[model samples]
Target: MIGCRHRLRMDAAHGRELRDVVEDSGVRQRREAAAAHRASVRDTLIAAAPDAWVVIDPELRAGARAEATVRACEAGAQWIWGALLPQEPDTGRRGGSEILMRDTDRGGYIPIIVVNHKVTDPRRPGPADFHPLTSELSRWNPQPDKSRKLRQQPRDQQRLAHLYRMLQRHGLASPSLLGGVIGLQADRILVHDIAGVLDDYDRRYADRIAVVRGQSPTTPAKVPECRQCPWWTRGAEGASCEQWLTERHHVSLVAPGSRAEVLRGHGVTTIEELAAWTGEAPQDWQHGPFDEAVVTARAWLAGAPLVRRFETVRVQRADVEVDVDLESYQEHGAYLWGTLLDGRYRPFLTWDPLPTTDEGRSFGEFWTWLMSVRAAARAAGKTFAAYCYSRTAEDKWLYESAERFAGMPGVPTVEQVREFVDGPEWVDMFQAVTEQFICPNGKGLKKVAPVAGFSWRDPEAGGEASMSWYRLAVGYDGPPDLGQRTRLLEYNEDDVRATLALREWMSPRQPTAHSAVEQVPSLADFALDPRATPARTPAPVTASGGGTLST
Candidate 1:
């Protein structure tokens, strides 16, 4: 009891023991960390080693076997060894090794490396030495005391050797030749005249070449030229026109026989000729046939400026006012309709349903609203305009309901209306539309109005809750009798508002204050001509297994 009254204290002996425990624990932790780090380093080193080649017991004359031999040579392998089995049963108990030599097309005797137990020596054999010559082999061999062989590499690496061999056998053995092959592989150009291309590059880039003597374009000395010419075309005064031929440009010159024959056949000999030939211009010369390509190439070489056609002009942001159109979607099974600016429904002017249709009435309404809204906004003296997001909300909801209504059977009789109103289907549909299109994940008209800087307060009803006109009118579907007339008008009005809003948003974001609209034509229309020539399609191919798909 007397000893317990005082706090316990460790003596020097006890203190030494406690310190020893802590030191030992720390030492254990450090050892584990060091071991882990060493393991990681060892794994990385092993993984970085190149794969080993596995030769067959008996070598084949052609295919992958031949390809691997060539690749090993190109990859800087110094020797080729073949594996052989010991004719004497006591030589190793497992197998033996040997080197192979074969005839090459270049008049030299090339060695083929194989790893097997049996071999018929190409040369008079004497010693049990000699193996494949390779940097990896040198590094791993020379120490006969080592028992294991190098790890075998994957078959894909061997196949890669085959691909390179195929390319080398073909016309692509040099860099210029290689670039042409690459260009063709990338679909950028044709690989014609590979040898000429290589020779051309060799002659041009072989020495120090001066391009221009001075800065002024007035003198031939001022404008420099390239040392190497890929096209091998030359001009007078020690200048080459090859670069001009290759560089892309818009204007094109054609020998009337070459150019006129192609265009006149297609009925586009001149601009007025083109106009009379086809009311609408061609899609684009980029998408044209080889004749157009030749013309374009010639034009660039001759330094002709591109001709501008008014029909190709784009509408600029500053020169003209913008308008937006928005219309609500009204679906009715096979047929769908809308009433522009009103929340009513119409029967005949509606869109078709899916499976038989591309897009819903909603998309069509959006397009119509865009066309009209753009025109109207211009009239209202607004260059950029937008329709509020509320219109999208309304249209989306209506589409969902109309889809549900269409899927139901028979006609909408008196009892059917009551049932439609009270059934689980109606309740679920209503809830889904509310949750998905109306709430937090989505926007109600009231919320987006403020985001777009519209400060107008909405009207509310009842003590239960307050709501805006946009919210209440949303998805009302209108009276069935009116054929969606009111719905269309309401929808379109919203579209116009939203389009106006978008334009306002875009105006401030422009990089410069420059008016883009100044360059556009007021109202240019080009009609499609029936007399235009059609392009020919390539013939389809069918194989024994199946016909291949084409774009």
Candidate 2:
């Protein structure tokens, strides 16, 4: 219910899922592991509670929900594990909770879900304070001040709202309208005021129900959600959203989200129309500058994925440059630091599963090596810079590893990380790309690097796939998979190499060369046709593949 609306509509229509050789085994493993963790935590949480009516039936047999309801009504047992709440079909809400506890009033039960991600940072201030041992949820009282502010996990809030509404329908909900979630740290249950998010959940659910009932058309719009959606590129039974967008040269092919919709309202539906647009801005235009949008559309049509924003394009380069890439498993410590300097690909990695003691040791070694390289460059009086595709992920671990392993030898201090990140010595290639060029096709390393003639050795070199490989490599449950470990190392190495390739391509080490902008086609070069070339011969068939055209 909380997923993509298009996916929901398709599911309601019994749409066939994409049957491609998808790499979902790792995703499956992650889900399974999370479920296992949730189950283990739930068991531990309710173990000390008195007579917790544990529902073990996975199928929720004929009388399971009934029995659970009867037990919940008793109110004697404060904790109920694996609760199968009664379904409210009219409201389109039905689900089970990992743990349901008696509300503060004890008049009804409130839902508690166990999730894989962290719900709150103890270091930060939040809305509620919960005690796991007693399962008590105390609302924030500024007088005493004990809160770990809400951690932007809207799905959990929506889910709690869903369960709360279900409880209300059954006459077993408190007026307080609250719920709880036990995150990765099982010691704490981050309770929430479900009342705050109920309206949002209601609005979303009502709209999704309309979509499911075919009352709303699931028109595919090019957005962030489309990346993981199966209906992208192609669907199981129809021409995909990709095909539809391409055929019309949809403005969204370049401009994302509501920008394209707003453009359409201005009679600019296709990329060609947007490129040709020379009119003044609408009275209340809030979308970005008209000039930039037109330039992007022109870039898209000309197949120049990136267009220079100015006459001159430059990237920060140094005599001694190191391309860096860091890999981590979903919120678990960063396990690998891959660096490409000169021509060598050196990797600092831990073979053990992440969140292990060895992670600190590995990180310490990597930090020491990196600093040594910088120190050597300074000693030689040669300028130095370390480059990463994006600094956000790398910057996070750099500071966290320091804080996480404060006393560990060789671990860089938070101040050191801050200095490096803030200084010009640490260059972000993605930021450079953003500053120097407008990328119509999007600026992801995988998307932009290929334009710079960089390709990964592994076809499936992505964060998602790496997670599964990490699990197998570390032997999460069984013997170590050496092949997977090798794959991970290779992937990490290639990532660093890709960044290096992008760096050299953007700002060549050679004294004189055509910059990225000078090397690619410009709008004038595509006067006849966006894709046309002077040396190109026309294709034998028609655009629709109906018949051969006379050359």
Candidate 3:
């Protein structure tokens, strides 16, 4: 209910066909690392505690374990170390939170989940998210703390609610409806009000139950989750939603989500139908450029990957431009900052394991180098700019790095980071592509960069693979693989290079005659003068039979 419906369908109907994306992704390893971190935190928390806790043996049988837990609850054990709990009989919903503490007033328990991400920030003077609790000095005692604003983790809260439901069913819930979270910093416990999230949880839970019971629609829609879903793989006969959509050239290929549904409502069932469409758009149409969407479909039909929305390509370009790409390890820190300038790739990175204090050195070096580049460009009266595919991740790390290493040598102040990012000189090429072109497929850097004739050296060059490589390169799990370090550098270099290539290709005048306006078809190529044209029926864009793309 919370995620992809298509994946839900796959799990329900063809549970065995889902493929684990292990060939080039690090999701499994990353999950393992997270689990390890959670366990380590749990171990330390339990180790530091007094003698009032109850630790159940995980190896015990279900019935036996349930009995043990019941015994502990009956005895009013102050703490339950593990998150595991007994399954309920009626709904069969069963899961555990990391830690459970006895609610003194309520005579039951509430969970304190161990999470590997930040749950709160230093907040302003306002109503507090929680009363801070320390285990040793202030165990079970929440003290006044108005400086913490909770980071809303609805999913986690939903999990807490799920556990709450199960506990309530089993008569083990705290009447207060409170839960706690131990985030990455583990500085203090942030008590969460489960009642606040219970309504949303109930709604989601009911919907999901409907989905599981075949009472709700299981039709697939193209969502971000589709890219990572194992069921999206090929050769599931007619089961793979990805194969089904791509092979049929689903209208969602161009007009995704609600727009695709809207098109279907108007008899534009396929991309071909949308492409051949010559009538007025729906009276209630509000989606971006209905005509531009038709052109995108036409581009897809013409086997063109991209369609030019504007006649002459326009993108920000500087006399001395630098392409930038940052590589990060989970939520720890950015380990590498790769930059390209003067046709040279410079990688300022740390070989020391992540979360190390030495991360400051690498970050400081990178910032100092980048600032020098900008300073020199301004001093010489040459325009300077930096490019990245997207600003979200880079901006996050930039701001975070500044905060994390504020007083380090060469580390810029937060204001400096803010000024640079907000400036027009820091260009996000992805934004430029979305503004200027109609990509029949998605407008991801990997997809769009290929249109600009840029390719990574390694076929496995992707964020997922980089994570696995980073682990090996930094010896996170074992002895450092030097080969992966080189591979990482090459990958980062290619990413920055890809950004530069894409920017140049979008430029109207460049050394290479590969400008998008010249290479790709403009709207004029397949566009019909709607006022002068008559209505036309859709031609078959694919083979004879195919299923509908939406519910």
Candidate 1, residues 470-508, lDDT tens digits: the string is 223332333233423344444444434433442343233
CA lDDT of 95 in candidate 2?
80
Model 1 weakest 10-residue run by lDDT: 1-10
Candidate 3 lDDT by residue in tens digits, 1-551: 36776576557766664455343356586567678778777677667875767887778887777778778878888887664777765564777777778889868888788887787777657664464433321286665566766677766778889888878887889998988878777778877678988888888887776776677886666766666667666445475677788778788877877787788788776777787777777776688778888777776766666667777887887889999999998888999999999899999989999888788899999999999999999999999999998889999999999999999999999999999999988999989989888887678888877766677799988898788899899897899999999999999999998888777777833455443346566666666643332133222222112321110
- Which candidate number maximizes TM-score? 2
Candidate 1, after superposition: displacement of residue 547 in Å?
59
lDDT of the structure predicted as candidate 3:
0.77
Task: Give the clashing pairs for model 2.
Answer: 125-149, 126-147, 126-148, 126-149
| Of 1 and 2, the candidate ranking higher by TM-score | 2
What ranges in model 1 sit over 4 Å off?
1-48, 51-519, 522-551
The whole-model C-alpha lDDT of candidate 1 against the native structure comes to 0.29
Model 1, C-alpha of 392: deviation from truth (Å)? 25
- Local lDDT at 339 for model 3: 98
Give TM-scores for every candidate, taking all chains together and pairing residue i with residue i: 0.18, 0.84, 0.83
